[model samples]
Target chain A: MTPIDEDPPPPSPAESLRMIAEQREAAERQLSPDPLVYHGPWGVAWLVGFGVMFLRHGPGGTVLVAMPAWLPLAVLFTLLIGAAIVSGVLAGRTSRHVRGRSSVQGAMYGFSWFVSFAGMGLTLQRFDDGLSPPNVGLLWATVAVGLTGALHMAGGAVWQDRLLFGLGVWLTLVNVVGTALGPGWHSLVISLAGGAVMLLLGLVLRRRPAGRPNE
Target chain B: MSELDPVIHAQARLRVVAALSALPEGDQLAFPRLQEILGMTAGNLSVHLRKLEDAGYVEVTKTFSGRTPTTLVCLSRRGRLAFEEYTAAVRALLPPPST
Candidate 1:
């Protein structure tokens, strides 16, 4: 066999500069939090939880109308709790090898949800005696959906992700329309529309190349 | 020539430091992930990382994830400052922007 040189010649100054520039761009990309961390599996889990809740309680809730109202509530509570646990486990496993603002952002994102939900719960409780159960549920749904949409927008702002921000805007519109339609239709709207959007986003994230910018 | 930070001046070391600096404060990247991101061989990456570690510019932590051992890397405070200074020096070498 003919002898071949094992090593290539050193890069010219122009090549070296180009290489450095490329590396710098890659490094800059890393500054942003990984979109998949929040948008992929965790997002899907939340969507699933919300979808189940809407189907049980919203207008589409007719399927479960025969069952005790408390039963659906209980099931929703369990499903959300279960989803939270699963999301936590997955986050722990996947985040083991990665680090950055993602942990902080994730924590903040979660805190926003907690605060929004808690506030909605307390507000609903304060007016509990005045409103019918379904009416109260409708109000709760509107506020909760709106709050989540706002939070998602805020998160998008922080991460500079247009897709996330767009989702937020869409959800906010859904909340408005659902509110006008009242409890039954509102739940159905959120379940079908919100769930579909979230599912699509999750799948898109899953298919994205790892570490690529959200843009 | 501008006063470049020799510690971060090397191509490999500069890339490593740049990547670490890109992370949020106190966050880190696992060794394998960093290696993959930089597209360097494990041995080559180790050599570059050792130089930075020796200079106290990088911090390396060995931890276990279940049964597997993992190596994590992060830029130290000094490293961040050094990289900043290096970038500033490079910018200084460039001519002023045109009007």
Candidate 2:
């Protein structure tokens, strides 16, 4: 058989592992404290809040704790918890995909978030003239923030759920819209709605898949 | 065609395939950007990449990003054809659903 007819042998386990390591390293090199890490955390924070809603709603009424009258604080706490959980889950899943696949997984990881974040941008601009004109300046500022978050989420995709990147983007966009929409209390609606969407998205990710194992 | 053939297929490498497959002809990825996307150890990735290089599936080029060394990966024509063939073969193997 001609050399052209012969297919290249598939990559070895060691080689596959090596590629993942390299991509992870490259991600780290590009990360910066100013944006990638910070916005990343912010995006994760919202995802966790979305996740918690599932826990709260899935289980029947446990004793509800009524604390002080600080609405902002309440939202903050929920957001924190939700982001943490979502971030953790996403990280684990992305990591698993990366370890089993190749750098293309990383790109898939990045592309997903980019699309979600971009979608959020489009959604927000369309709804700008709502009850509260999203702090126009702040909303614009958050774009940079979202990009940073995208980078961070993608970084996590290095070893976490490749799909988590999409979750991160959606969460970040929803929060950005929520923040622009109005006071925290009102924003709760956005969080709840976003959570529902994320749950569906997660299920979808669990279903449809990327093609070809990295060789 | 080998069905269920086990080779070095790992997460990062698979990621590379997915990324390349998505692009128009000749679109490439820089090493650092890819690293951020995959989140693996550098030493580990480089070794696998070298194997891809040797295999003629991926082409790597060294250039200067400022003064730093940057490696870019792109799907070689051969690699693209192989992937296309592999995908077609996989699709052919899928069981048809009952009406």
Candidate 3:
């Protein structure tokens, strides 16, 4: 233990350099973002929202549940909006105290999410009267999920996280296959492949030690 | 010979400066957080931080968080330049790389 006033004897030249490197690395690790914080909320949102949608219908236009079709859509949108809000506020806190390149990048990425979703929502609404219920449903589901997958891929590339990029690719492929399979199955694929996989990843990876110790 | 800045040459203060320098310009860390990282007692860290503050090498801000008192520390602009100079001086002590 070092006394308050006593300094350690002068370190050797190599030792001094090593010490500096060690301290910088430790501090950076402690300050890095947490994966769980990023993944958990979205995982839950997709899983529950899509899972409900899957249960509301069955194969070959059979109605499995008596509830209105709007119920599942409402649940999915509500959960998705909730997930977006929670993630934004929590993630924003990390960059709140500092202003620099990383901070600017975070802000811009967040704005992109807002802008892309808003634009998609507006374009879809323009077709409200023209498109039939089934066609519009297909459009909304495919467009939203597709945009999410594309954005995830973009984010993964920007952050250089291979797992995230892979997940985006996985989501995109499953989304396409699910759309082709049709009639209640699209939601099934999304719930299981997209939502469940994310939840599993988010939960399992959460157990891995975070770079920073909790304060 | 390039001389080390005496204010930063001390091991504890050198470590504190090194850790703080990792933060981006104008960013700050709370006192408890710094102490936790360094594994130092509050008294030891406060003394070293005080010395760095006196030398115009670090900025220390004391304020209340809700009801509790909090100390926030950041390396000043002078401190960053001093650390850069110090690292360069330390490098000067080493022999040049062989081809």
Candidate 4:
């Protein structure tokens, strides 16, 4: 058993400061949470959701799967909703132990997500009546993914995480290319290029131990 | 010369205070989680924590998370002020930087 009664000599002033700095960094790491937890759910959601879409409407609008028309939309909505709920719960769980400016920032960020997505949903529904099926799919794909990328970049800026900001930019560029490819191919591109990137990054990050260089 | 807190002057308690102080105001950590962060054995941690609790520098709460009991620890407002003072005192001990 380690001796509790015995006391070590006090560290020098500089050494004492160093210890404090180290412990503070360690505590910050614990408080902030793992990035992998945030990324993994979104990755799976996009991969499965878009993968199904790609199968239902193959590249260049060629019908690959013979499933009922409603099945694709149903599956996609279910997965996206599930992922959103999980991400919200994870964020809440991690922040429940702490409070201050960061908590307020997180809450505002979450609200922004709701507001932006709600607006997108309303606008998409309004336009759904006017557009053809393929065009409708293209509209939803570009706008939703584009907004998601912009919001993600905003979040990254708020947190000052360069990697996350880069990922957001990558998502935007991926969608741009997917948009150029048109409807059916867009899903395939997003599933592989955007969603798969998140999953791969999550895997890589989880394997490495968390640390910050001394500052 | 007596600016340093005798209670916080001890190395183990100093570390405990420092770690707890890092938490945002009103934030807490599970006992096991704190022990893991500090790399201290359970018994040793309990001993130091008792000292801190006795000094009124930390609050230890016994609560149930589902069926299991959890001990949550947080630095009190008094403890935070004390840490700030302790830090100032430590800095005061060092000689001024040469031009």
lDDT (0 to 1) per candidate:
0.68, 0.49, 0.78, 0.80
Return the lDDT, model 4, position A88. 92
Best model per TM-score: 4
- Per model, the share of native interface contacts recovered reads 0.27, 0.05, 0.46, 0.39
Q: Kindly list the per-residue Cα lDDT of model 4 for residues B1-99, writing each as its tens digit.
A: 764677777777888888887676655788887887788999999998998888888999888778988888888888888889888988888889999
Model 1 per-residue lDDT tens digits across residues B1-99: 654556676666767786776566767789987886798999988988887899999999988878989898998999888877766666665557889
Count clashing residue pairs per candidate.
1, 49, 0, 0
For TM-score, candidate 2 versus 3, the one ahead is 3
Superposed model 1: Cα runs more than 4 Å off: A1-68, A90-102, A211-215, B1-26, B30-44, B52-72, B75-99
Ranking of all candidate structures by their DockQ, best first: 3, 4, 1, 2
lDDT of 1 at B92: 66
- Model 4, A1-215: lDDT tens digits are 13235766366877777777777767766766576777887888788789889998877677787887678778888988887898898888767644455678889999999999999988788888898888898899899999989988998887777777888999999999999988888999999998889888888877765542311
Q: What stretches of model 3 exceed 4 Å from their correct place?
A: A1-30, A211-215, B1-99
Q: By DockQ, who's the top model here?
A: 3
lDDT of 3 by residue, B1-99 (tens): 756788877788889999888876656777887887788999999989998999999998887768988777889999999999989988888878899
Worst 10 residues of 2 chain A by lDDT: A29-38
- TM-score, B chain alone, candidates in order: 0.93, 0.78, 0.94, 0.95
Clashing pairs in model 3, backbone N/Cα/C closer than 3 A: none
lDDT, candidate 3, equals: 0.78
* Cα lDDT tens digits for candidate 3, A36-104: 667777887788887787777655656777789789889988988888887887767665444445566
Predictions' DockQ, in order: 0.20, 0.12, 0.28, 0.26
Q: List pairs with backbone clashes in candidate 1.
A: A59-A184
